[model samples]
Target: MANLNPYLSFRTEARQAMEFYQGVLGGDLEITVFSEFPDMVQNPDQSDLVMHAQLTTPDGLVLMASDTPDGMPFEPPQGFSVSLSGNSTQRTQEVWDALADGAAITMPLDTAPWGGTFGMLVDRFGVPWMLQGDSE
Candidate 1:
């Protein structure tokens, strides 16, 4: 069996970002720093950087992330949003509100023309998100 999950790239905030997601999504997060794999971290300064972080939610949502290794170019997040949609309005709202904390709301959560509540925001970690709730 196999599943496709979103893998994110951060300059150095993978730990904080993963923790934030865990709080919002209710998940178990496992993090590994570059130092854990000595061979991969050539620079001592980068040893403390996140090599890998995984957050697995009870609903089976998996979010993975890591920091850019030494000498790798960092690219700012753009052009995409991690979207969440479901029939549970209450649960969707709760998740939206959680992600809204200190996040820049590009579109306030509201009833969409296509029906249902929809919203867009860029989290503090610079990750974009879209949330949707059931129409009715």
Candidate 2:
């Protein structure tokens, strides 16, 4: 059996981003820092950085993330959006509102020509997102 989910990479914001997601999505989050594992422990200055973090939402959605260790290349997210959709317009709208805080809304959520509500934005963490909901 196999499960597919989004795994995010951050220059150093993995903890903050993951915490924000938990606040927006109602989830249980588990986090481990580089300091927790001796072998994986980086220099003392970088030891507190997030090594891994996972958020499991009440709806069973899973999101994972980690910070790029010091000296590694870092790149901002681009080329794709984390697309979210659902049958319940109200519920989807709730999520949209949460994610919209501190977000740059590229397209306001509204009726789509294809017969649904759709919007796009780049969230505060620099992650792009596309949201959709059924027209109720």
- The lDDT leader among the candidates is 1
Off by over 4 Å in 2: none
How many angstroms is residue 122 displaced in model 2 relative to the true structure, after the best TM-score fit?
A: 0.4
lDDT of 2 by residue, 1-136 (tens): 6898888999889999999999988889999999999788657788888999999998888999999987788888888888888747787788889999999999998888987789898999999989889878
RMSD of 2: 1.2
Please, what are the lDDT tens digits per residue for candidate 1 over residues 76-126?
899888988874777888998999999999999998899889999999999
| TM-score of every candidate | 0.94, 0.94
Question: Least accurate stretch of 10 residues (summed lDDT) in model 1?
Answer: 83-92
Model 1 backbone overlap count: 0
lDDT of 2 at 128: 92
In model 2, the worst 10-residue window by lDDT is 83-92
